[model samples]
Target chain A: EAGVTQFPSHSVIEKGQTVTLRCDPISGHDNLYWYRRVMGKEIKFLLHFVKESKQDESGMPNNRFLAERTGGTYSTLKVQPAELEDSGVYFCASSQVRIVSTEAFFGQGTRLTVV
Target chain B: TQLLEQSPQFLSIQEGENLTVYCNSSSVFSSLQWYRQEPGEGPVLLVTVVTGGEVKKLKRLTFQFGDARKDSSLHITAAQTGDTGLYLCAGALTGSARQLTFGSGTQLTVLP
Candidate 1:
């Protein structure tokens, strides 16, 4: 089966611009997650979607960032008025369930650069 | 906030050498997972250890979960150039959301 896939492998935008990253999860997977890694930093969770509903979004950095998984198949993360700090690699992952120890499959990631 | 601390921040070793990386935390987790990420790629799950004191081996790679469930270690035997990448450790806490808390990561470079 094909693994999770992300769109626009690399994106470069000017400061204050808007950017949207997309992710397509594996077939029959119900758990989708968004994460990002800033320069020289660890990957951080942004939010999680279980089916079409968001299960957790506490890791969202600010109001400028928004994520949605409509119909529970794919997900999109949008950053409005993107700042320099928003430049980083955005990753998407999916799993079959939220069990205690299930493995999550990750996409290659979308690298965003704000100049 | 739950935090997973990984040590050695970076490692550069010659091929056929052995190395070990550690992940520690003060908080107990119900399960922990290790991942390997190459440049321009997302992290790929390596293994998940759910039980305390559990040891799982994948070829030359061995993973051990702490008896207290607060730490874990990864040992790579006779490392090769293929093992060069970033290793990350993540934890899933009990009663919390299913999201994972990831460690800073250890960047490994194996010289050929």
Candidate 2:
């Protein structure tokens, strides 16, 4: 079985441009999550999806950030009109457990650079 | 502000040395987890401590949860170069959200 996979491991976009990050979770996993790590900061939670339904999205920064999980297998996070502060490493994770605090497998992460 | 506070944000030690990293918080969590991440890669779960005052050991790494479930610690014995990476601590509060609040992370560099 393959671990969680993220596409375009590295992305460089100009400020005000739009960038979409994708994540393909492990097969048979029901819980998928998105996180981001800014320079010199802790990795922060973005959102979570339980199948195709968004379980929680309180971590979303603003309306410019949109995350969708179509069919509950893959997830995409789109940053519209990206800003300089939006440059960071975006991570995707998945877990087999339906409950909280379980072991989660993470992807290599998409390093987004907005200059 | 970060819900979890990890001390010694960076540490450099020689191989065969022992070190202990700590994670603290004012808010009690239902469970806590420790993860390690190398360059260009995502974090990998090291261990999870659920019960307060519980202690679990994996190989040379020992994890301990606080008596009140508000803190945890990770101790590495005879550290190896392979252990060099970023160590992160996360806590999960009880509720349906199930989101894990992460710490700032400790970057450990073990030199041979």
Candidate 3:
């Protein structure tokens, strides 16, 4: 089976511009998660989705960031009027179960550079 | 503040050497996992320790969980160049198992 896949392996945009990153999880996986790692920081959780409904979004940085998973399939993360601090790598992950110890497969990640 | 603290944020050693990295936290976790990530790629799960004081070994790598479930360690024996990468430790807190708390990560360099 294919692992989680993320689009636009790298992205570069000007400050205040918009960018959308996409993620395609493994087939039949119901749990999807988003994470980001800024320069010299840990990879922080952003949000999670079980099917098309968001399970948790407490980790989302601010209002300028939005995420959606339609039809309980793929997911997208959009950042509007992006800031310099938003430059970092965004990662998507998936797992078949919701248990704490379940194995989660991760995507290569999208490197975003907000100039 | 970092919930999980990983010692020696960066490590460099010659091939055939042995090294051990540590991950510590004050909060208790139901489970803790270690992952290895290469440049431009996401982290890959190396091992997960659930039971306190449990120890698991894979090839030349050994993983140990603290007796309190609040810490973990990874020891690499006779390291190889292929072992070079970023090592990250993440945990699922007792109640909040849905989200994982990650450490800052240790960048390991094994020179051949």
Candidate 4:
């Protein structure tokens, strides 16, 4: 079975530039999540999608960040006019979304560096 | 905000030694999970403890959940070089969405 996969393992962009990160979750999984980890900081949750609907997006930092899951398949997170603070590693994970503890499989993550 | 605290931000020890890492929080959680991550890779789930005071062992690693469901511990016996990585503990607060609040993380190094 294929695991979660993310695009552009490393991205380097200048401030005020726009960047988009993509995530392809495992097939047959209903739950997809986005997370971020800044330099010297632990990983933090960004949002979660259940199929095509967003289950929870309370973790989104600001309006500059937009996430879309078209057709409930792959997800894309776009950062407009990225700032220095936007430099971090973005991770994507997928699970079955069950009442019981369903293990979440994470992608290698996209490392973004905004200079 | 719910936060998980991890002790010993970093640890370095010789192989074959034993060590224990802890995760604590003031808020009670419905479930807790442990993950190990290597550089250039994402974190992998190690174990999940739901019931309070529950204990689960994975080979040389033993995991224990606090009786109050507010704390947890990971004990590694006969640590090996393969065990060296970043250990993270996450909590799912009761009545909240499936989002997990992760701890500060503990970096463990096992020298060969």
Please name the candidate that would achieve the greatest DockQ relative to the true structure: 1
Model 2: runs farther than 4 Å from truth? A98-101
Q: Rank the candidates by DockQ, best first.
A: 1, 2, 3, 4
Higher-DockQ candidate of 2 and 3: 2
Clashing pairs in 1: none
lDDT of 3 by residue, A18-109 (tens): 99999999999988999999998999999989899999999999999999999999999999989999999999998877444456778999
> Which DockQ-derived CAPRI band holds candidate 1?
medium
User: Where does the lowest 10-residue lDDT sum fall in candidate 1 chain B?
Assistant: B92-101
All candidates: DockQ: 0.74, 0.73, 0.69, 0.68
Residue A48 in model 4: lDDT: 94
Task: Report chain A TM-scores, every model.
Answer: 0.96, 0.96, 0.96, 0.96
- The per-prediction tally of clashing pairs is 0, 0, 0, 0
Cα lDDT of model 4 by residue, B11-107, tens digit: 9999999999999999999999999999988888899899999999999999999999999999999999999999999888888878888898999
The true-versus-predicted C-alpha distance at residue B105 of model 1, in Å, is 0.9
lDDT of 1 by residue, B17-44 (tens): 9999999999999899999999888899
- The TM-score of predicted model 2 comes to 0.96
True contacts kept of each: 0.76, 0.74, 0.63, 0.59
Q: Give the best candidate by lDDT.
A: 3
